[model samples]
Target: MSLSIRNQIAGTVTDVATGGAMGSVKVSVEGGELTAAITKDAVEALGLASGTSVVALIKSTEISLAAA
Candidate 1:
Protein backbone atom coordinates (compact mmCIF):
# COMPACT_ATOMS: atom_id res chain seq x y z
CA MET A 1 0.00 0.00 0.00
CA SER A 2 0.93 3.65 -0.46
CA LEU A 3 0.86 6.38 2.14
CA SER A 4 1.93 10.00 2.38
CA ILE A 5 2.66 9.82 6.08
CA ARG A 6 6.19 8.81 7.06
CA ASN A 7 6.07 8.46 10.83
CA GLN A 8 4.98 4.86 10.61
CA ILE A 9 5.80 2.66 13.58
CA ALA A 10 5.75 -1.08 13.11
CA GLY A 11 4.05 -2.90 15.96
CA THR A 12 2.04 -5.91 16.97
CA VAL A 13 -1.49 -5.58 18.19
CA THR A 14 -1.72 -6.25 21.90
CA ASP A 15 -5.38 -5.65 22.64
CA VAL A 16 -8.67 -4.52 21.17
CA ALA A 17 -11.62 -3.06 23.04
CA THR A 18 -14.84 -2.20 21.31
CA GLY A 19 -17.93 -0.53 22.66
CA GLY A 20 -21.07 0.97 21.20
CA ALA A 21 -19.46 3.25 18.64
CA MET A 22 -15.82 3.53 19.57
CA GLY A 23 -13.00 1.09 19.89
CA SER A 24 -9.54 1.08 21.39
CA VAL A 25 -6.57 -0.63 19.84
CA LYS A 26 -3.38 -1.28 21.71
CA VAL A 27 -0.16 -2.05 19.89
CA SER A 28 3.17 -3.14 21.25
CA VAL A 29 6.06 -1.24 19.68
CA GLU A 30 9.80 -1.33 19.99
CA GLY A 31 9.94 0.76 23.14
CA GLY A 32 6.43 0.55 24.52
CA GLU A 33 2.76 0.28 23.79
CA LEU A 34 0.40 2.77 22.17
CA THR A 35 -3.36 2.86 22.09
CA ALA A 36 -5.59 4.33 19.42
CA ALA A 37 -9.25 5.18 19.84
CA ILE A 38 -11.26 4.72 16.72
CA THR A 39 -14.69 3.90 15.40
CA LYS A 40 -16.10 0.48 16.04
CA ASP A 41 -16.81 -0.06 12.36
CA ALA A 42 -13.23 0.66 11.51
CA VAL A 43 -12.10 -1.85 14.07
CA GLU A 44 -14.18 -4.55 12.46
CA ALA A 45 -13.25 -3.50 8.94
CA LEU A 46 -9.55 -3.90 9.67
CA GLY A 47 -10.09 -7.18 11.51
CA LEU A 48 -7.66 -6.12 14.21
CA ALA A 49 -6.91 -8.50 17.05
CA SER A 50 -4.24 -9.54 19.46
CA GLY A 51 -1.06 -10.71 17.72
CA THR A 52 -1.95 -8.89 14.52
CA SER A 53 0.84 -6.96 12.85
CA VAL A 54 0.11 -3.33 12.15
CA VAL A 55 1.64 0.04 11.43
CA ALA A 56 0.88 3.07 13.54
CA LEU A 57 0.70 6.14 11.34
CA ILE A 58 0.93 9.46 13.07
CA LYS A 59 0.08 12.78 11.49
CA SER A 60 -1.26 15.94 13.01
CA THR A 61 -1.13 19.68 12.70
CA GLU A 62 0.56 19.88 16.10
CA ILE A 63 2.92 17.01 15.40
CA SER A 64 6.40 17.63 16.65
CA LEU A 65 9.37 16.07 14.89
CA ALA A 66 12.72 15.60 16.56
CA ALA A 67 15.76 13.54 15.81
CA ALA A 68 15.73 10.20 17.55
Candidate 2:
Protein backbone atom coordinates (compact mmCIF):
# COMPACT_ATOMS: atom_id res chain seq x y z
CA MET A 1 0.00 0.00 0.00
CA SER A 2 1.03 3.56 -0.63
CA LEU A 3 1.19 6.17 2.11
CA SER A 4 1.73 9.91 2.08
CA ILE A 5 3.41 9.86 5.48
CA ARG A 6 7.17 9.91 5.04
CA ASN A 7 8.20 9.21 8.63
CA GLN A 8 8.02 5.46 8.68
CA ILE A 9 9.83 3.25 11.12
CA ALA A 10 10.12 -0.52 11.11
CA GLY A 11 9.82 -2.20 14.44
CA THR A 12 8.69 -5.29 16.30
CA VAL A 13 5.52 -5.43 18.34
CA THR A 14 6.52 -5.62 21.97
CA ASP A 15 3.11 -5.40 23.62
CA VAL A 16 -0.60 -4.89 22.99
CA ALA A 17 -3.00 -3.60 25.59
CA THR A 18 -6.68 -3.47 24.86
CA GLY A 19 -9.42 -2.05 27.00
CA GLY A 20 -12.81 -0.58 26.39
CA ALA A 21 -12.90 0.37 22.71
CA MET A 22 -9.27 1.31 22.33
CA GLY A 23 -5.97 -0.48 22.10
CA SER A 24 -2.37 0.51 22.60
CA VAL A 25 0.41 -1.12 20.64
CA LYS A 26 4.03 -0.87 21.66
CA VAL A 27 6.70 -1.30 19.03
CA SER A 28 10.38 -1.66 19.77
CA VAL A 29 12.54 0.46 17.51
CA GLU A 30 16.28 1.00 17.30
CA GLY A 31 16.90 2.83 20.55
CA GLY A 32 13.50 2.92 22.14
CA GLU A 33 9.87 1.95 21.76
CA LEU A 34 7.00 3.72 20.07
CA THR A 35 3.44 3.39 21.27
CA ALA A 36 0.35 3.93 19.16
CA ALA A 37 -3.21 4.15 20.35
CA ILE A 38 -5.77 2.75 17.94
CA THR A 39 -9.14 1.15 17.86
CA LYS A 40 -9.53 -2.34 19.15
CA ASP A 41 -11.20 -3.37 15.93
CA ALA A 42 -8.24 -2.11 13.95
CA VAL A 43 -5.97 -4.09 16.18
CA GLU A 44 -7.98 -7.24 15.51
CA ALA A 45 -8.11 -6.52 11.80
CA LEU A 46 -4.35 -6.19 11.63
CA GLY A 47 -3.91 -9.26 13.85
CA LEU A 48 -1.42 -7.37 15.98
CA ALA A 49 0.35 -9.37 18.64
CA SER A 50 3.62 -9.59 20.44
CA GLY A 51 6.53 -10.25 18.07
CA THR A 52 4.57 -9.04 15.06
CA SER A 53 6.50 -6.87 12.66
CA VAL A 54 4.98 -3.56 11.69
CA VAL A 55 5.82 -0.25 10.11
CA ALA A 56 4.83 2.84 12.04
CA LEU A 57 3.89 5.78 9.85
CA ILE A 58 3.96 9.08 11.64
CA LYS A 59 2.24 12.12 10.20
CA SER A 60 2.30 15.15 12.39
CA THR A 61 2.58 18.87 12.05
CA GLU A 62 4.71 19.41 15.11
CA ILE A 63 7.41 17.38 16.83
CA SER A 64 9.60 18.17 19.82
CA LEU A 65 13.11 16.90 20.38
CA ALA A 66 15.04 16.86 23.62
CA ALA A 67 18.27 15.40 24.85
CA ALA A 68 18.13 12.83 27.60
TM-scores of the candidates are: 0.83, 0.86
- The digit string of per-residue lDDT tens for model 2 on 1-68 reads 88878788999999999998999999999999999999999999999999999998888554567898
Question: Top TM-score: which candidate number?
Answer: 2
Q: Which ten residues in a row have the lowest lDDT in candidate 1?
A: 56-65
Cα deviation of 66 in candidate 1 (Å)?
11
| Model 1 lDDT tens row, 24-48 | 9999999999998989999899999
lDDT per model vs. reference: 0.92, 0.93
Q: How much does candidate 2 score in TM-score?
A: 0.86
What's the lDDT for candidate 2?
0.93
- lDDT measured at residue 22 in model 1 versus the true structure, 0 to 100: 99
TM-score of 1: 0.83
Whole-structure CA lDDT of model 1: 0.92
